[model samples]
Target: MTRITVLGGTGYAGRNIVRVAAERGHTVTAYSRNEPASPVEGVEYRTGDVQDPEVIRAAVTGTDVVVSAVSPRGELEGTGKLRGIERRVAEEAARAGVRFGVVGGAGSLFVSEGGPRVADTPEFPDAIKPEAAELAAVLEDLQSSAAELDWFYVSPAGGFGEWAPGEATGTYRTGGDVLLVDESGESQISGADFADAVVSEIEHSEHRRERFTVAY
Candidate 1:
């Protein structure tokens, strides 16, 4: 079984990844600022700050993959904080010889021809812009990193998250950067289905050294 460390493991996306990974029998260690109110069985929960490189390194020790699911909120300060955290995670993962994967924002995903990002669309909420920008910066850093450090940034479709929980058919479409929309013209997937795709990537290594998006 693959040993995995999930940074920001208590967040919406992180919890799903942790749950799915544990259900699949992979040893999962969840690193977050606070422990989960109800921790899932078969997953180890550790409380620590992601900004600390040494702490992050300790959490990732003996793990094959590190999934970053942290969402940094607010304005410029928040963006700087997230950048620091991402850099620390990448540096520590490289030092520990572990593969890194990130749950990136849909803001970086391409829309129509010569159009704006999904986050830039009118439908995208203004409140989440800062967090999306932070994720985009982290993705850019990962993409420009050296080849020896294997990293993948996975971005979900436009209508991701709790509000738009699409039915899980145990299947979804995957694409690189471009947004994936179903035949009905909806771009969304359930948390479970997104988790399924994340776990699949962890096991199969299909999209490596790049970013990918999922939808149903």
Candidate 2:
């Protein structure tokens, strides 16, 4: 089984990933600022300030894949803290020969070819723009990383988040760069399904050193 560690294990996206990975029998570890109130069984939970370099190093050292599900929000919003943490984790993962994965935002995805990004659209919320920008920067950093560093960034559909939390259908569509949408023009995916997609990537090693999106 693949050994996986999620840096923001208690967050919305990170917790789902941890649950799914553990259910799949993978050795999973979740490192977060605080311990989860309802921790997943068979998963190890680690608490620490991600700003510490030693914590990042320890989280990346032995895992086969290290996923960063942290987002820029709360105290981290507008601080550019998530980007810095992700960059350091990426560096540590590379040094340790572990695959790096980032759970990114849909803001960076193109609404159409060679055009404005989702975050750039007039209808997008201004408050979320900063978070999206930081996540986009994380993707850029991964793209420019060394060739030996295997990494993948995943941007979920536009309607993703705790507000929706759609049920897993065990099915979803995947795309690159462009945002995936249904015929109704709705772009969304369940947290469970998104976690499934991530674990599938971990097991299959598809889309190496690239970014991919998920939607219904």
Candidate 3:
């Protein structure tokens, strides 16, 4: 079983990933600013401020894979806090020879081949632009990272979030830089299924040092 650690283990995406990884028999560690309200069994829970370099180093010290499910919102919104944390994690993971994975926003994905990004669309909300931009910057940092750094960034569908938590279907479609959408033109994926796809990648090691999207 792989030893996996999630940096924002209490958040929506992180919690689902922690649950799925533990259920799959991996030794999982959930690290966040606060302990989870409902902790998962067989998983270690760690509470610490990710702003501390030591905390980031500790999180990546021994894990085979380190995933950052942190979002650029709240105190982190527009502050580049999440981006710095991701960079630190990436550096630590690289030094320790651990695979790095980031759960990014859909705003960075291209709407079509050789076209505008989702964040550039007029329909995208102005309020969320800051958060999206920060995430997009995180992706850019990963892309320019050293070749030895094994990393992957995942952008979920446009409709993803706690506001509309979809159910798990044990199925999902994956794509490259372009965003994936359903036949109805709806871009969405269940939180559980998205977590499944992340763990599946962790197990299979596909899409290395690149970005991928998930949808129904």
Q: Please give me the total number of clashing residue pairs in predicted model 1.
A: 0
Candidate 2 lDDT over residue span 16-60, tens digit each: 999999999999999988989999989999999888999999999
lDDT of 1 by residue, 43-85 (tens): 9999987667678778768899999888775222465788777
Q: Which regions in candidate 2 have their CA more than 4 angstroms from the true location?
A: none
For all candidates in order, the CA lDDT equals 0.85, 0.93, 0.93
Considering lDDT, where higher is better, how would the candidates rank from best to worst? 3, 2, 1
Residue 47 displacement in candidate 3 (angstroms)? 0.2
TM-score of 1: 0.93
Reference-based TM-score of each model: 0.93, 0.98, 0.98
lDDT digits (tens) for residues 78-111 of candidate 3: 6678889899999999999999999999999999
lDDT of 1: 0.85
Candidate order (TM-score): 3, 2, 1
lDDT: which is higher, 1 or 2? Answer: 2
